[model samples]
Target: MNRREVLAGAGTAAITSLAGCGGVSGLFARPTPEGVYVPDHVEGMEMVGTATLGDVRVGLTYSYPHRFWTVERDGDGYGTSRVDIADDDTVHLMAVPWDPETELVLPNTGLSVAIRTQGELVSQEVIYPMLSQRMGFHYGANFPLDGDGTYEVTVSVGGLSIPRYGGYEGRFDGAAEATIPFEFSADALSAIPYRQLDERRFQPGAVDPMSMDAVPTGVAPDPLPGSQLGRGTSGDAVFLGSVVTADRFGPDPYLAVSARTPYNGLVIPGAGLSASVEGSGPVRLDAAIDPELGFHYGRAVPGLTPASDVEVAVDVPPQVARHVGYETAFLEMPSFTLDAE
Candidate 1:
């Protein structure tokens, strides 16, 4: 089978698995938990849970409409559509230690985190203190609410030894767990700006074609074909040049290219961009903006070899949106490679 077909089959398999884990029906079926803590003092993120594991403190922060994952659906009679699902409402878990003088964050290698929901566990991406925000070293990942209910979050830290300072040293070799509850409301999801971009294209002054009322109530229709979802940030003044590659995309491989537009100084998800690889197979692909990732990506490229020459070209077209806060911009997607891992 061709590469696209392989990705389609894999996506179909994924949809089948997601169906049992509360795909669309979960939106209305789950009830909000009682006395949900809306902690105003913790950097605007609602503190879901926190625990003291040894001498270190680990905390979790969650928000809505944060990250997204999408699935492709086969159409019965109508044409196929890429069905977008907001699986990852953003989640951030941070770790810090108490000290007589100040808080000391741990090295990224010192700790790891994972969350359990609906019997599935996903590992969090560990960010070192220096790379992430100051004093906010974290193990972070976004989660899709399978159904309204509590999820078990586990923060595991291995034996970590800190150097002696002022007559004291520290170490942690345990795990902490917390139960986090969620309320899934289609109404609340409707308020997010990007949710409006789920299925439709951007047009000036045009009404959103996929209203919340139009969303499926029973089983979600098959995700539309070639749908893309991602998240990224460039603020409103900086342009970031980026490149990404994948060793595999379900028996196949991929090379994605993207760059931030000077207009608005950001990468706009859902915008269609063109890409090409210059090497054997010389694949030419279209990269789609994934607003959830805030970047454009090409997930399935055919016949990519590790020895392929390192040249990826991306063409980002000018975007003009008078209604929204955007205008025409251009991008110079940088060149990069990903060694097999």
Candidate 2:
């Protein structure tokens, strides 16, 4: 896990649709179970602080591998107010509820949360990746990640008058820096076996080590469009489409990604696709990352605004420049949905 290589922000793919307006009441609404909401505290790990305001209860916990912390409402399903650590120095908040009253982030990340209240002083501190930028009552920023040091990251949700952090270390992968900020969750626990991505998700071959070009390596994609990446002979999981196998790391961390220009930015990110980690869990769609890009601005399309609609994911992990559009475009595959049995 290389944090600096892929610390990302929300993708602004759909900025134009919102006319560059995000965090508005209905600018980017999503579906959720309707009810009078009340926040809940999570149990386990190191409980930091808990506070309740305007019917909203918030708490913090210290997270490490093998520990669990969750957040829930009186009647809401359970999850956690979690900070997750990726392979590198990348850090993220998880299971944080998205309030309709809050504003939207368009398509900045694979997922986006809204702050619903402007003068509403809601604040949460995080681990790695400094956050320090705010747009109006909305907040967001990009922080860099390094696989080295330990650091502090704080995320405060107040008015957009306050700023969210941005680009921690200018987005570089495999950087040797100590960047321990945010918290940690399950995703930060381990390399989730492909099969366990979902329930009843079946797959063949090794986890994160599928075959491509009739060779063995990372989630290998088909060399030719019609080729096969894996054969699901072990269980039921299938390698939906081409996969990105092997990563050649480097100095010019972010360079260029192009499908037409082979080898330079070669990666197959099967979109809408799914793969199960054979023996353990459900099928989940994943794309191989470019260690160079390091999940920062490599995929940044100029002019992308705050309201662009993008996939529901953590900040885009960094990849060298070679990761730019190759996955999103070239390896266009169907998303893998959990076939719960």
Candidate 3:
């Protein structure tokens, strides 16, 4: 079987086992009292609102306060630890930023949110870029509200630190903010669907991403534009390589690599990457967005040919927080050689 088929089969088997009661060991058969671990599945969250800010469309959602994990730098690699929900935690706020045209979720956006009532700031925080089984990739954090009342949520999106290409050039560079009013009440928060898994509460696999009404679930597009080089996997993150020549990217050939999650094809951003062509030395690839390629890492390579032997190295793993099934992957990725088409 092909690599993608193998990955799909493995994921399916694991998820099936997780849904059953027979395969889980005694250690993980029960749910944790505190801290974050894998769960069977989380139901869909209710949308707070959505607004357009420059090139980005931000959607906000909320769920019951959750105990989640955070990723931090650890030596040469990275590490994950739990963030307990505080006693005063009222809701888990999530922000999803995406390209308005393509609906592809944007990463490394450096999102910050402020909650206010009666023109007085109540709470504020810089949310974490995170991954989850249901939400895919988004910016989220636990927050305490000022009880039930009318509140104004101001979401501020910072400039894109990564490079931009194609129609994305010079865009998302300036910070933009949007405020949406919301009615917060215990009745509305309690109405959100919440379900606990029976035996799969702490199992090894992930549930499917939740289908929201108008929000993008962070999935990358398949069959990317340009000449297909081939596909490879590193650290359970799938990488698709392609070459494209465009007037916007200059005269040389541009190499684009799209990194994504395995089954769901959610874009993985905020990674440091480099590419080498025919042992000609490494070229640092900048995390970029394009009209056709979506979210990818790319750099112009002079004298790039179809026969060039290309290798991609992950200098830094995705610097975003992970939910459960994703925490173990996208770290410790090995450099992989692309098979030229």
Name the top lDDT candidate. Answer: 3
The sequence of per-residue lDDT tens digits that candidate 1 reaches over residues 1-341 is 22223224445655455432322212222232211111111112334555566555555444332211121222421111222323454333333333212333333225455666667874444432211111122343344455554566666555443222122333343443334444444333333222212222232212211212211111111111122112222222122222334222345554444433222122233233433344543344443322122223454655544444444333332221111112111122233332222
Minimum summed lDDT over a 10-residue window in model 3 is located at 18-27
> Taking the tens digit of each residue's C-alpha lDDT, what string does model 3 give over 1-341?
22223224446655354331211221143444222235644544678999987779999998766666676788877866767667678888899998888777888779999999999998999999998878888999888888999999999999887777767788888899999888898877766654445675565455678888778887776776887877788988889898888898899999988988877788888789999998988999988887688889998999986567889999988888876556567778899988743
Q: Name the regions of candidate 2 deviating beyond 4 angstroms.
A: 1-56, 59-89, 95-143, 159-341
Residue 182 miss distance in model 2 (angstroms): 5.0
Task: Give lDDT: candidate 3, residue 197.
Answer: 58
Top of the candidates by TM-score = 3
The C-alpha stretches of model 1 lying farther than 4 A from their native spots are 1-43, 64-103, 118-136, 173-341
Alpha carbon lDDT of residue 14, candidate 1? 53
TM-score of 1: 0.31
Per-residue error at 186 for model 2, in Å? 13
Candidate with more favorable, higher TM-score: 1 or 3: 3
Query: In model 3, which runs have C-alpha deviations exceeding 4 angstroms?
Result: 1-38, 196-205
TM-score of each predicted structure versus truth:
0.31, 0.18, 0.85
- How accurate locally, in lDDT, is each candidate? 0.32, 0.22, 0.77
